[model samples]
Target chain A: MAQTLILEGNEGYVLSEILKLSDAQHPTGYLSNEEYTKYFLKSVKGVSNVRKTLAQQINDPTITNVGIIVDANSKGTKARFDSIKSTLTQYLPTVENWDYVASSPAGWVADVAPSFRVGLWVMPNNKDDGYFEHFLTELIAPEDESFLAAQEMLTSIQKSKNQRFPDLRAQKALLALFLAIQEEPGMSAVTALRKGLLRHKHPAARLFVDWYENTFTLG
Target chain B: MIEHLTIKNFLAFPELEVPELKLINLVAGKNGVGKTALLEAIQLYKCSDKIGTNRLISENRKGNIIHHKDRIFASKLEINNLSMTMAVGDYKSKVFIDGEQVEGHGHPDDYPNHEYEFIRSGIKEHDWISRRWSSFVLTEKEELVTEVISKVIGLNIFRIAVTDQSIMVKIAGAKNPVNIKSLGDGLMRTFQIAMALVDSKPLASNLIGLLLIDEIETHLHHSVIRKLWKIIFEYAIKWNIQVVATTHSQDAIRQLFYEAAANESYQEKVQVLRLQIGRSGKHEVIEYPYEKLEFMMDTKLEIRGL
Candidate 1:
């Protein structure tokens, strides 16, 4: 049977990028189907708009495993993780705590009626705060001059204004400007990942890639 | 109440199972997705009247009934542990309960007599309802009919008169009482269902068990669909009847979801069953609980997967 994966947003850009990498890394049987059913990569969209259905998705009998991808955002990594854990523990009361240091990363895997596995990864590394953009910013090479220049320029402009915005907002401004220089300027992180603007070989990218494979592909 | 259904090689279904069936089930799917076929399968199970082997085969066949394909198909319905399994093979068909042949009510010596009715869409000469209504107006049951119609249409039916040749009915707004047919197809559809519920309610010897309907909201306006669903839902609960109906109306689904969520008592009784293409490229049925369906409605996701 094919498994279902739930994502945090309605937009498909980020998911498409993740799929591109997962397919390339593990092309064999990454997606499977039955004789009469065409089971592709299943992903449930989530947000405040679809929050009411999250419990249903978690408890649906047909799903074998549920992979949740959300941004840690202002809530911070561990807090966001705990928020999900608190909401979902009612369904899978025995869900294990998040363990980030493990080779595959720790997931709240549950084996109960409609039994299935659960895996969650907060964007930009489950251990850090900020949104997915912060994680994408980690892809910038340490010696890349243009990106360093953009950061310097953003800091100078803000410093000249008495630094009206916090450091997090300033970093986001720098990232958006840096991404705008690419062929598809101002595109989403998934779009950047798809166009090879975001280096897949970066260590930060590898951490998420490892968590995804270990949770979904590995036994 | 019927709680579950399992099908194997029956009609359009090669292998399909609905593990969770609620009291008021609203089934939605795209065309050719077996929405009608699901009802037909239920009709077959509720066939208390005897059917010829050849006739049954031809009725369920896709193209030529004699064409070469798997000739055996089965459907099983469960109400608690008391289950009924009906299997058709080639030109022969049989009904079994606990692995034993059953010659249920109706037919005296042969045939199964299940207490259920399957109302199909399209214009049909509803002379039977008129004849029943004519006599029903003279008895104490007239008020019951009026109550059902009032609940469904949201207007009191002032008078019901029966003549030797026709039945005359008057609603709250109409000036002149007219023949039942004058009210139009939509009103007729509502009357048919209301009457069915009244007649099928627990009687001296029978308690209505199931109702199989094809496009239960056909010929009805969106506003009327909402009211009609309320009437049907009320009767279903009061009479202890399990309703299995198909519909292509999103309005009907939204109304169902709204009512089910708003009413605590209905939360466990109303369910939306979606038939869509699974990953295997064949039809698969999924149940959307009341809360989930409401979420889908709020998100504007096409419930039918169109």
Candidate 2:
């Protein structure tokens, strides 16, 4: 529980993403059987019952117990970290802290709201255990030619950048260089993630993880 | 060519669905058994948009929206032999066109999409009603009277409701000097009828066209009624316009059948529907052969309400 995990912060961001995604009425809200049938079954009748279930799930105690704590200015783990320690004291029965989950103030309200929050479920390409990922990619990827091209450009650059370092050092070096290149003006979003990986130098890597965590933990 | 129409969705009678009709249709009901309602629904279906117009100013207004809703039935008016399969809101209602199913839209909006196109005889629909209207009375504001025959031939006309009986349809032109009240009520009614005929000149939708007149013998002497019937019958025959009017006057009915029986042209063309709506809330539109409707008044027919 005391151990620090590098990907844990990204996992927090994904959780936040999952909550936001679930916020819309489509996936998890008042989808009555009769309404669903009328919408899809071609029958003429009123539907009820689904709206309340979704409301209850959103109001449930489990997620309420899983509170999040975010620290804005850390000064490399100084009073900011102490503030986190202080906040964690009051948020009990919620795992003593977000030990099992990730923390970031970003998207806090969206994650807490019922029937609407649908956040990060799984990591992209990493296939990591996390929030569910059912976003625009499923529908747009099949038809969007531009998105396919951009995806190709990003992976190609990531590959070329990876080859610049030895195989053993490549994983760490790649992200650090990609992060730096991403900071350039008018940078492609795909390149930004790759360049963000460039900050994989131990200190910057720690920071990259923190940035990802804040995105999900802080609202 | 619907001879009769009957509907029963009133609180007095919950389940009565027979619209007994033949070549000559008649509706007879006391005070109110949804008699006028049945008539209005048919009118709404046929000409809802024409409920307003400037063309009928010299005549009389129609297009009256009358309603007395009950908690039981939403709207219960039995349609007979509707050819169009109307799609209203959520239901696909069937229509019998001379005992045959009409393919495509039954709803008025979908009328244009139906395969059956009602192409008029070399007359642009726009100018058709207007052309016919040219022959009608168009009085100027200064009370001058002139023929509107050319103006009404090809133009879309107007609609009328029961409440519209008092309003002016065809009016004096801007320069005319005749005051509308100066004319007798019978004259005003005649002007309304003429305007309506022009309004309904097959220039628009081609569904069944019926000119409904309630108490046609209104505000006129027996002689005037006879004269009016002759003119109405002639107009109905010439334009293929169907007339389904209600009247309590035997003198009026007798004169009509007498004229038709004596003349070959009036024999099969002129019709009368005997209408009777009872406390049961159901209406009966007994189609009379020739003008037997004129003789039904003497018959010992016992209608619950009437």
Candidate 3:
């Protein structure tokens, strides 16, 4: 059986690392906007492209499970989740007769027709208006005291008029600075996770791991 | 255009339904999944000469001239408000208009006059190509075909002439006209496909033409498939013809998608249908409209079935 995890950007590397940390088998396939450069889904003309992708995946007989991961951004977790739900509702084959109810916390898993499951998770703990970087920031190991320093520096920068980054990019700037000071400096989020720089047992991390396990239970 | 098709007891398909067929539909599936059978079903349904169609289908399959056991072929087609259903068996054949059965095993006069051309895979017979060429020579359609060959295959052709034994093309600056067969298999296949499309012109302005091609990528190079599809799309729209083609080549599907997506008006006129045999021993169809096809091509997903 083929299972896929679709991400909005190049977050597959980080998600792959997290799956390893959780001692879970990685999904059979991964799709992200990075691979779709010509028809990127982020563009206005490509807004409904995700729905189109979902329609094809849902019809594939080999695919038994699918997981969608996208940022909440300014839309908030509820709006993002609702948008995904709408897409699913519109594209799911009418023959499947899929009936979905939101799961606890901020994720959903539905048993569709012909023996397949679909799951959706909004980023940043699935409750706040943030992105993958915000979720990554929450995984900073408690013993890493430099994280607090990074946060303070970012807060000061936000208050200053000279701040170059937009308010929406605060989490990304903080994570970058924090990673810059690590022992293996300038490593990507995935490499940092591999080196045990981020705590896998954090509460936010546990919620996501639980969602993944429940969504893709193997035979 | 035939918007939907239903088949029962036709070839290997016990029961199947395909919906939302567009102007240009590409059918893809694994071997024995009945890609060619689907084309035969459409041809059998549209052909007014049922006896001749049955003989052609049987000859194409190389099946026995006479069946030892009874086999039934039934189909239901929907186009706009018109609905047609036909069931052909060993003993008798029946055709229905809307829901009422026509009298006397359904005469050819009872059916709408729609032109049909079913082109099989591989090199076509020389006589068939010559005959198709004979119909279009010295007509406006002949110039259209010549221009398409010139633009797509980069061949400078002054005219196309049919000899007693072979069809020949007069290339510019050439001493003698060369035989079309000597121009290589790609050009010959392109010539056959182009002729099939042009020959399927409807006799009446209100009638529609149907062109069913099997394994359209048989002798086409990857580089030429895109240009060939461009010609197909242009001709299909210009002539008000509906095209249903089968292909196993990923390049064929990709190029078709790119060509369709490049034009705004052609975007909605293309679709891909995937046929698969379900675990229940029944055939199933999955449709990928323009948007879904675009997404699959963009993400490099496997649109061809296993």
Candidate 4:
């Protein structure tokens, strides 16, 4: 059976778009015939919810492998990794060995052992403290000057407001505003990506896409 | 309490090993899927000495007990302080404790046919059932008997005594005192379980090692079974006892899930093993956790097979 993929929060939209784009680019049967090679994606409300489900998932024999996606906001990559590590170890003591993959400037993926190869990706990349928006910001397609002007305008607005909004939230708000300015307007990240408005082919986004494909691809 | 159990060449099971057995385990499966055989094997290992081989063979239907491919049938159970092994075949039914031979395979005439009183099943005679109630009344353990009776049977067994010919008992709703035999099978089943569980100085404490029942939902309503289960669960935890019972009723399992959901720990303690015949004509055991079972129950899946 195909292994289960767990994502933190309601990140299903972004994940589904990524999987759709990857399948179109790499024509793999893993996502279609789930019993043999397809990956099943599931998202819990938050990290604590993931902890609870992960505790039970480790004991479930049918679930061969697990993939987790979380934001490494504020708490650095190691702290984010330890949050899941403690829960996994408490439930399954046999878990050992860790391979940290440096996928991007803000993404970090760890391959943990003991049969269930748990892969963790902390956004925006492996070395920094940021959320999904921080990673999504890197996929703004460098040549889009209108989005650049929109980012500057939002930055000036935050400055005028005495920087009350957090840096991550400020950037996310700018991104959301820019997405709303699109031809369709108010479309989610996934829908925008499908409409060819979001740069799913950007190198920064491709790093995450490749990491996801490689981690879940069956031998 | 039995912490682990393994059976080989026993009925439909050629080799079966239940490694992570909890205190309150429920065996569920389709008909002729070896659910009863599993309980029978456990009883043979623990309570067989009480009822001799002849009675056991007759009631347990040991003629077809062995697997078709294997001649030697064996079972191993790990109890609180003892490890027991039982092997039955043409050589004879032999029982060993801690690797030391305790009983021979042949049926002995003089050997006490029955000893400990707690082991009882729907197919077994009630005369050999636990005499805990009689002992309770005889020794003035009325408080314990009445307390357990009301909790398990939902009827106040205020009066109980041994007559010259039989045992008489009176329930709160009944018109008058009647023979315990006249109370009906459901009441009888409840009484046996309650008597074995209720703490009384007259009965042996260690006899509460294992509670094995085939089709535990027999002769009982879903609500009554749930109530009985609540009492059994409390007593089982208090006495550190392990319960392994089989049931084919979805109502029985619905009540169980309702109970487990109430007490969170009970969910972990309850292991539902569903046995099904695989394509190879061998029995396959599928274990469902409480959460998974609840999902199935909610989705109205057919958990009970044919």
lDDT to native, each model: 0.61, 0.35, 0.70, 0.62
Model 4: CAPRI class: incorrect
Lowest summed lDDT across 10 adjacent residues in model 3 chain A is found at A38-47
Q: Which parts of model 3 have CA positions greater than 4 angstroms off?
A: A20-52, A72-114, A119-122, A125-130, A162-169, A180-187, A199-219, B64-114, B134-144, B159-169, B176-182, B204-206, B277-284, B299-306
Model 4 C-alpha lDDT per residue in residues B51-122, reported as the tens digit of each score? 444455565453543333444443322222333343322234456543444433422221222222333346
| TM-score list, all predictions | 0.58, 0.35, 0.76, 0.56
TM-score of chain B of each: 0.76, 0.52, 0.82, 0.72
- lDDT, residue A210, model 2: 41
Q: List pairs with backbone clashes in candidate 3.
A: none
Question: What DockQ does every candidate get?
Answer: 0.07, 0.00, 0.16, 0.04
lDDT of 4 at B208: 37
List runs of model 4 lying over 4 Å from the truth: A24-39, A82-97, A101-115, A161-165, A217-219, B1-23, B26-45, B48-242, B245-257, B262-306
Q: Provide the TM-score of the second chain in candidate 1.
A: 0.76
Model 2 per-residue lDDT tens digits across residues B148-254: 21122221223211122233333324333343335455544454455554444343444434566666666666766666666666655654455656565566667
Q: Rank the candidates by DockQ, best first.
A: 3, 1, 4, 2
Question: Per-residue lDDT tens digits of candidate 3, residues B61-133?
Answer: 6631312125332232221132234332212345543344432222332224434778888887778777878
**Model 4: per-residue lDDT, tens digit, A54-135?**
6545644445566778877788888777788888677664556653444444343344544456767787776688778877
State which candidate, 1 or 2, has the greater TM-score: 1
User: C-alpha displacement of B230 in model 1, angstroms?
Assistant: 1.1
